[model samples]
Target: MIEAGKKIILFDGVCNLCNNAINFVIKRDKNDVFRYASLQSEIGKKLIAERNIDISKIDSILLIDPKIAYYHKSTAALQISKQLSGIYPLLSVFLVVPQSLRDWVYDIIAKNRYKWFGKKESCMIPTPELKALFIDQ
Candidate 1:
């Protein structure tokens, strides 16, 4: 089980847009407030099962804050943006919009992600220095 107080981000492993987003998060997250796992990994599977979240309904970003709350889709993105450095924090303003509208935009991009950005056949192997940010299988 993941430790309480830590925030975990579960993402699509092979999606290019997702990969780039992960890299963007890592670069801007100077405080290191996040850990990551590809949704296809063993750790990811276990976490999803343990949390009792329905996998069929979860294809976008997932933010798991143990013993607190979890968020998905546009909510997850906005929440993460609030923690990032620079003008990214400005994105929090969009939270005022209704969730349905926000998620509609997210879904459009997610549905065409592979076609627009391509995908890898397998998950990314993090560099040695960055490996500690990921949970073990």
Candidate 2:
């Protein structure tokens, strides 16, 4: 079941870069504010359909604030950063740049992520200790 106050992060399951980013967030998430699901999961697909997101256009990351809002690409990255512990919140300052420009850079990284970071044979399987942090694992 989805928790009441946690934001949900949907990510590319097989992408090593995305997996690393999620681990980074988990380490810095002092407030326990996020849950995760792979974009290939049933819940992830359901959320995407509910939001009417075009997966062909946004294949990297997504942040869903439940009933409130959803953010994708650089905006989603920045939003997630703001809640993280330490100086990471400052990264949100990049929001001042236009979304198109920010997403352009993000696209470059996303496009090469598989080639640069490699791909998993399948979606990540959270360890028993971290299982609660994931949904539909």
Candidate 3:
């Protein structure tokens, strides 16, 4: 697991889109500002319970910044975009568009994700080079 103060991304490991999104963040996060965990893992479950988060209502991305706070769905995506390098950082502008509208779009994509992107039978195995970046359970 990451140190207490570091930011961590909790995601759906079996979802292809979610997996690709994690890779996208990994590539743009030049500062290495984030760590990752699959929402299905023991650590992910423990974090949810500790935070008093209702897993049944949240199936999208979650960004946890320890004592600072956490963000879900569109908010999480925008918060992460702000930390990325290059044009990726520009995506943060979408935050001004009103959360309900943005999340409506996000929800559409999320709801259809498995049918559209396919799923892995098991969790992803990070490559040896990027192994250290993940928080193993």
> Highest lDDT among the candidates is held by which one?
2
Q: Could you tell me the TM-score of candidate 2?
A: 0.98
What does candidate 2's lDDT look like per residue over 4-123, in tens digits?
999999999999999999999999999999999999999999989989999999999999997788999999999999999999999999999999999999999999999999999999
Q: Count backbone overlaps in model 1.
A: 0
Query: Who wins the TM-score comparison?
Result: 2
Model 1, span 47-90: residue lDDT tens: 88888989787786899887676899999999989889999989
What is the TM-score of candidate 1?
0.94
Q: Between candidates 2 and 3, which one is better according to TM-score?
A: 2
Q: Which ranges in model 2 have alpha carbons more than 4 Å from their true place?
A: none
The lDDT per prediction is 0.88, 0.95, 0.89
TM-score on alpha carbons, each prediction: 0.94, 0.98, 0.95
For model 3, give the 10-residue run with minimal summed lDDT.
1-10
How many collisions per candidate?
Answer: 0, 0, 0
Candidate 3 versus the native: TM-score?
Answer: 0.95
Clashes of 2: 0
Which stretches of model 1 miss by more than 4 angstroms? Answer: 1-4
Scored by Cα lDDT, where does model 2 land?
A: 0.95
Candidate 1 clashes between residue pairs 3 or more apart in a chain or in different chains? none
